[model samples]
Target: MMQVKSVTRIFGQKAALDDVSFAVEKPGFVGIIGRSGAGKSTFLRVMNRMTDATSGSLMFDDRDVLALEGGAKRAWQSQCAMIFQQFNLVPRLDVVSNVLHGTLNRRSTLASMFGFWPDDDVLKAFAILERLDIAEQAAKRAEALSGGQQQRVAIARALMQDPKVILADEPIASLDPMNAQVVMDSLRRIHDEDGRMVIANLHTLDTARRYCDRVIGMRDGRIVFDGTPDQLTTGVARDIYGADASFNEGATSTAIETLGTEGDDAYAQSMMA
Candidate 1:
């Protein structure tokens, strides 16, 4: 299980998170939602230790996450893999090599440091790409793939770390509708099939309700709501994003039409009420 206690973060006098505390014991997707500057991304950063909290403790299993330092800190980060909004793959590197980078912490020796990755590691990288169904693009340069494909490659890279948890911060912010589904599906498949823990920061309430096992709402650095996807009512969303404001989801007309066709109106209404 992952636990965060009374987490408070501040920059100058402005609080980014105010005494936020939550836990996730299940192994499916847990989504973080809020408007811009709502402290959604900041919370994800603290989870992965990308940024430290001004106060409170983060723990995984029995490990004191906030106490890790030096090589241990690096390794812990590897164990808790992160995927970013912008696909952070090396553009000049082939997809396979970029995926292989996940193993760097384990084999940062002189020879491995010189790019002499073992054959076993190579096989592992190939297997990870296959797992994400992107082995075909292994040889392609990361710059050559579409935004969706790059994100998938990024997922594969994270998987290569053999992480205990996956943290994705605004991962679909740049994709088109089709690409967004493509990326979300890949992550969902991983969560369901591999049973690894996933924490995603998202903008679209619909996607969060559909894809996440639990939805966590934050505003001005405090957790306002946290519950299963079914708990993400329209009122809840309106509370987070404010009412009457259009939220961009990159949702396709076809996807929305399909949702509307298949009792989505009723589903949405019931939850909202």
Candidate 2:
């Protein structure tokens, strides 16, 4: 479980996260939705300690990640890998090499300091690529693959670390519709297949309704809403965004009236409404 206690972040005179608090049970899939500058990305970064809050505490599984020091912090970070909006891969490195990078933690003093390591995990890295369905590009440079494929590579790199929590900050924001589906499907499959905790930040309400088990809405650096997809409605969305939110599927908290193959038929009903 992860507990965020009255977390707040300030940027000079402006508040980025204003006393936000939430507790996420482990092994659950969650989606965070908010407009730009709503502190969505900042919240995710706080999980991995990529950014520090001006005050407040964050705890995971009975451990205070922020208090950890030296190798303890490094070990905790290795167990929680983050995937960003951009595919932050070594563009010139082969996909296999990038995945092997996840194993850097296992290296010893001379090996790490001198940039040397034990036997390469090329075979294991190859297996991760195969699981992500991007094995065919393992020998290829990271820059050569398509946008969706590169994102998958990034995911595989994270998996190679065998993380307990996966924090994705807008994993599909850079793709087209087709590519977005591919990436979302890949992420969804990761949770369903491995039962790993997936926390993704999304811009579209429809995507939240379609993929997440529960949606958390943030406004002005505070969480304004948190509930199952079926709990969403126009009124709820209006509070999250505004009156125009109803017309913009990207901003609404869509209520999943029926848990079907692809959730409720909001498309047909809302379009007619």
Candidate 3:
């Protein structure tokens, strides 16, 4: 279980995360939704230990997440693997090599710097790629792949960490609707098959309602709502986004038909590329 107590992050007198507290008692897919600058990204950064909280505590079981340092901090990072919006892979490197980078924290720097990897790790990387249905692109340069494929490579890298939790910061904000669906489906599959926790910062309400086990709504760096997908009614959305009572939740939806492109270009290219 993970517990966050009174976590607050301050930057130049602005509280990006204000007195945020929550707990994860079980493994499931969690979606965090908010307008821009709502501190959704900041919360994930704090959870992944990419940044420190200005005050309060984060606990994973008995371990104090806020106080970890050096090796322990590195270990925490590995266990709580992060996936970013930009698909943070080395564009010049082959796809498989990028996935293999997930294991760096566990290996000696000399071996990693020399590009020496165990045969087992190599096989595991391929296996993970195969599971994501992108194994054929293993030898291709990451930059050659489409945006959707690159995100899948990112997912494969996260899986290689064998992480207890996956932190995805706006995992699909860049893709068109169809690619967005693919990426969201991949994250859902990882959560279902591996039973690892997935916490994603999402923009589209429809995406969250479809794939998430729970939806957390944030406004101005504070959590405004926490409930199941069905509970996210129009009024609740207004409250979360700080809109007036007449706000339409559909405005935040990225449903396939609404986007008009059919999202097929990258979807087909990813398969045949």
- The best candidate by TM-score is 3
lDDT of 3: 0.84
Total clashes in model 2, counting residue pairs 3 or more apart in sequence or in different chains: 0
lDDT at 132, model 2: 84
User: Which runs in model 3 stand beyond 4 Å of their true positions?
Assistant: 244-273
TM-score of 2: 0.85
Candidate 3, residue 187: lDDT: 92
Report how far residue 170 has shifted in candidate 3, in Å. Answer: 0.5
Q: Candidate 1, residues 1-273: lDDT per residue as tens digits?
A: 778888887766667778989876767699887766667777777777777888998878878787788988888998989998888999989999999888877875686557787898899999988887789999899999989999999998899899989999888877898989988998999998889999998877778878998889877678888898887766676676554445344433222222211111122223332
**Every candidate's lDDT:** 0.79, 0.77, 0.84
Alpha-carbon RMSD to native, per candidate: 8.3, 8.2, 7.7
Rank by lDDT, descending? Answer: 3, 1, 2
Instruction: Give the alpha carbon lDDT tens digit for every residue of 131-227 in model 3.
Output: 9899999999999999999999999999899999999988888898888898999999989988999999887678778999999988767889999
Clashes per prediction? 1, 0, 0
The CA root-mean-square deviation of candidate 3, after full C-alpha superposition on the true structure, stands at 7.7
State the weakest 10-residue window (summed lDDT) of model 2: 256-265
lDDT of candidate 2 over 1-273, digit per residue (tens): 889888887766556678988888768789987665667877777667777678888888898886777788888878888897788998998888888778777656565445453454667788889988889998899999888988999999899888988888888877787988888898899999898889998877778889999899877678999999778666776777544533556533343211112101122222332
The residue pairs found clashing in candidate 2 are none
Displacement of the residue 64 alpha carbon in candidate 3, Å: 1.5
